[model samples]
Structures are given as C-alpha cells and as structure tokens.
Target: MAKIMALDYGLKRVGIAATDDLQIIASAIGTQPTAHIWEFLKTYLAQNQIEAVVLGDPKNLDGSATDATAPTEAFANEFRKRYPEIELHRMNEVFTSRIARQTMVSGGMKKKQRQQKGMVDQISATIILQDFLSRRSNGLF
Candidate 1:
C-alpha cells in the first residue's frame, strides 16, 4: 500500500505531490527550494512509504529537451544514486504550468493566491501526478 510521489522540478523550487496508499487520487503536498530538495525528500521518505517517484519531463514544442531538462535529468540521476531502491519515471509536462494557471483561474482562486508561484508549482505537480496515475492505470506508461 505504498504511495507514489511526483515532482515538478524547477530551477529555484520544486513542486511535490503524492497519492494515497490506494493510489487512486493525487494531492499536492508542497513546494521546496531546489537546493534543499534532497534533504526534504530524505525527511519525507523516512516518514512515508513511497512506491516510486514520478518526475515532470520538460520539453519544447518541437519535442526537444528544453533548458530545464538537463537540470531535471541531473537531479533525477542524483536522486537515483541517493535512493537506489526507489524507481523513477518521467512524465511529459508540456503545458502543465499553463494548465495549472488556467485551472486555478477557472476554479475561482483569487488573484493574490494565483500570483503565488509556489501554489502554481504545487498544482502543476498534482497535474503531473494525476497524468502519471492515469497512464499507469491504463497500462500506457
């Protein structure tokens, strides 16, 4: 009954999300500074049972790796090195930020709240987790 976790990696900060033990729904956990992500994960993993880690794969419209891709890949590599037992998967995250913003707007989030980049990041991570869950459940991952 371990849960699955998702990460929306960014240059300055990272968004985090996790599913329940049943893995039926994804929920935003929080955001953390990029420099402290590993430390945060270490603490989090100690208290929670995570089956795997899903990372958002950033790509350009031409389907090429974006500027953020290399850093994310490096982070994933380090993550694997740090936690060799945990599986890591990447999910396409083409427009997760835009989609998250739109969702917030449509969901009646106030302008002040919407302006919080951390909130957007958390939502984007949730979206990425949900997408990964959907694909996984459909055997399309």
Candidate 2:
C-alpha cells in the first residue's frame, strides 16, 4: 500500500509524519521550517510513494475557526495548487499540541527534550496520522 503523509503545520515549523509502507504504523518523520517545507516536500515526495496528505485543521473547542484557521486554509490552497496530483485531506486538530505535551511528559522524556517545540510538533503529527488511519479503518473516512 502507498504511504500516507501527515503534517502538523504552524507558522514557523511544520511537523511531518507518515504511515509505514504496509500502512500499519504511523511514525514521526521530522519537523521542517515552514519557509523551507516546500523544498523538503519536493524532495521527499519525489523519493516516496505518498498517496495522500493529511493536514491538521486548527479550530476552537466550540468548533469556530481559531486564529490559525485562516493561515492554515491559505496553506492548504497553496498546497493543492502546487501538488495537484496528491490528494489533500484535513482532520480536526483541537488539542493535538496539549496531547503531545502530555504524551511526552508521561513517556518520561527529559525536561529539555519535552520542552522542545519541534518534538511536540512531531508527536502531534504522529497523532494526526494515527487518527486518520484509525478513522479510515473504521470506515468513517
């Protein structure tokens, strides 16, 4: 099966993740600077068999658009236009950052490591990928 990629995109950094070739496991790839993400994607997409891309859709708890919503939408539009061949999907991202922080704390990560913003971003991306796989397997996608 082709791999599915996920992104926890932010203004400064974008966290990347991908499912294994077998599509059984989601793994954190890395975090890339937002400014350089296009270059990274151009190379990675060329080398990998990615079938689709999942991007986090930031929203408030009440389902209203958050401050990040506009920027995320703009990025999505640009992504679609730039890579029309690859399918792009959005998944609600409410508390992914909080969850990632908690995960790192509970996982006994060193304080310095846990405090790294990039680490949290990567974990958040993995969570997004896992959520997509779970929903798709449950026929909810």
lDDT of each: 0.96, 0.95
lDDT tens digits by residue: candidate 2, 60-131: 999999888999999999999999999999999888999999999999999999978899999999999999
Residue-wise C-alpha lDDT for candidate 1, range 3-53, written one tens digit per residue: 999999999999999999999999999999998998999999999999999
At residue 29, what lDDT does model 1 achieve? 99
Question: What TM-score do all the candidates reach, one by one?
Answer: 0.98, 0.98
Give the number of the best model, judged by lDDT: 1
So what's the TM-score on candidate 1? Answer: 0.98
Query: Model 2 segments beyond 4 Å from truth?
Result: none
Clash list (residue pairs), candidate 2: none
